[model samples]
Target: MTTTSGFLLDQVMVTRGETRLLDTITAHLPGGHCTAVVGPSGAGKSTLLRLLNRLDDPSSGRILLDGIPITELDVLDLRRRVGLVAQQPVLLTDRVAEDLRVGRSELGDHGIRELLQRVGLPVEFVQRRTSELSGGEAQRVCLARALAVEPEVLLLDEPTSALDGVSSGVIVEAARDHVAAGGTVVLVSHDLAVVRGIADTVLVLDHGHLIAHGHPDEIDYLEAGR
Candidate 1:
C-alpha cells in the first residue's frame, strides 16, 4: 500500500549533553496503519515518538512527514496534526470538560460528549473534577482530549501502562477505532500482548538503535525474556 501521509526517518540521531538518546535510526511509518515501537526500558521508544511529533529535533539527519521535512512545517500546526498522549495525563484544569476544551474551542458540548464516549467515559464525567478521576480514567480523558483535535497521527506513549486490564482494553479499542477511520497511530509500549493485539507493524529498539522491524509474529520472540 502507498502511504501518502507516512513518516520517514533517515539517519535520525538524538543526543543529550553527553549521552546518545537515539542513534542513526531510519524507518518508515506507513499511513493508515498502527505501528508499535517496542523494547526494554531506556531503549528510546518514547524518544522516537517525541521526534515523530517534533517535541524535540534530532541531533543529525532528517524526519519527514508526508515527504516534507518536519522542520519546515509550523510547530503549532504540526502538533495539532500529530497529537500525543503521554504516559501521565496532564490536565489543564480541574474540570474534565475544561481539560478537553484546551486547544480546541471549536468542540461543543455534544462534541465533548462524543469524545468521552469514544474513550469509554460517561457523559456525566465531563463536569467532574480531574481530582475525582482514577489514574485510568484520567488517562482515558487525555486520550479523549487528543482525539478532540482530530489529529492525523496519534502518538501514544505507553498509554495503558498504569491502568488495569479492562482499562487497557478500552484504550486499545479507542486506538483501533482511530486507525480504522484512516488515522495513523504510533504506539510506544512494552506490553507485548497489547502490541500483538493492535499493531500492524512493529519496530524494535535497543540502546537507541533500530534492532528490527516487521510483523508482530516476527518480533514475538522479544517476549521470551519478559
Candidate 2:
C-alpha cells in the first residue's frame, strides 16, 4: 500500500453547467472518522463528497488528500482510494460476484463469501444473477463491492435511501462496523434520525454553502430546515 491518505478541502468551489453549486468552502474530514453531511434537496452536500473523491473537478481552489493535491494524482488511483456509492445503486456486472471482483483481481470466492457475510448476503448470492437481487440486497452487494478494495475514504450518497427498514438497518449496521474497523466514512442524508444515531460529527449545508457545522443534536435541525 502506498503512503497515500487524508483529505483537505481549501477554498474549494463546485459548478455544474452555468449553475454554481458549491461556493468556495474549506473543511477538513479527519481520517477514520464518520462525518455525516446533512442537508435538504439542492444543498451541495452530495457535491462536497463528489469533490473530495475527484468524481467532479472543482471550479476553483484545491482538494488535497494526505497532503497531496487531488489534481496531481492519477485519476484511477484517486478513485481507488475514494470509493463512491450513489443513491440509486448500480451493479456493473452480470453476476453478483463479478461486481465485487471488478477492482480487486486478487479476490476469490472465499474472499467474496466473507464480504457477502459481512454485508448480510447469503452464500447463494455468489452464483446468483445481479438482476435477481432485491433492492436492499443490491445495496448490500454494492457496499460489499466498495469494501472489497478497502478504500481509505468511503463516499456514500444515501446508500440506504432506497431500502426498506430491514435493508436500511443492515446497510447502516455494516457501514458502522466498517468505520469501527478503521475506515473513513462520509455520508449525505436528509434523514435526521439516521444521522443522529451514526454521525460522530455533522455538517449542515444549504444552497451549496455550509450553513451549520456541529453535532446534529446540538443544532435544532428544524432551525436548519428553515
Candidate 3:
C-alpha cells in the first residue's frame, strides 16, 4: 500500500454566520507520524478532522493532501483515502459483519475476523447485531471497519474515549502499527495521557484558533486547558 506524504492546512478557516469555528488555522501533519490535536471542549479539534476528510469544507483557505489541494480531488475518493473513525460509531447495517462489508466488499470473513482481533474484539461478534454492542464495542467495530478499507490517512476523533484500559491500549497499538506501516494518523483527544503515548507531535487549539505546535513533551499541559 502507498502512503500519503501528509496534509497541509494553509490559513484554513470555518465560519457559521457570526460564529467562527476555525480561524485561519495553518499546520502540517507529517506523513508516517501520529499527530494529536488537543484542547478544551469546543476547541474545533473535531472540526479540523472533519475538514481533513471534506466532511466539512473550510470557509476560506486550502487543505492539501500530498501537495495537491483536496478541493480539487473527488469527494468520494478523498474520503476513501482519508478514512475517519468518528467519536460516535455509526453502524450502517444491523449486523456487525454487514456494517464492515458495506463499502469494503473485498474484505472476506477471514479479513473481518482479523480486523476484529486487531481491535481486541472476539470473532463471534461478527454475527452479532450492532444494537447489541456496548458503546465501547461499537467503537472498536468502527475502528476495525475503517482499517478494513486500508486508508492512507486515518482520522480518529477520541477513538478510545469510550473504551476501557485494555481496549484503549489495543486501539492505540493499532494506530501505532498503522503509523509504523507508513500510514499517517491525525488524532483528536482530550486525554493527555493518550496523546503523550502515541503522538509524535501535538497541535493545541483554543476557541477555534491554533495556539501551539510542538513536540508532545514540549507542550505545557496546563495552558492547553485555557
Candidates in order, TM-scores: namely: 0.96, 0.91, 0.95
- lDDT against the true structure, per candidate, is 0.90, 0.82, 0.91
Worst 10 residues of 3 by lDDT: 217-226
Where does candidate 1 have its weakest 10-residue lDDT segment?
217-226
Which stretches in model 2 have alpha-carbon errors above 4 Å?
1-5, 222-226
The ten-residue window of minimal lDDT in model 2 covers: 1-10
Global lDDT of model 3: 0.91
**Candidates 1 and 2 compared by lDDT, better number:** 1
For candidate 3, write residues 26-129 as lDDT tens digits.
Answer: 89898889999998899899999999999999999999999889999999999999999999999889999998997798778999999999999999998999
Tell me model 2's lDDT, rounded to 2 decimals: 0.82
Clashes of each: 0, 1, 0
Better of 2 and 3 by TM-score: 3
Point to the candidate with the largest lDDT.
3
Expressed as tens digits, the lDDT of each residue in 4-93 for candidate 2 is: 445777888887788889888777776677788877788888888888777788899998888789899998988898898877789999
Ranking by lDDT: 3, 1, 2
The most accurate candidate by TM-score is: 1
Looking at model 2, residue 89 earns an lDDT score of: 81
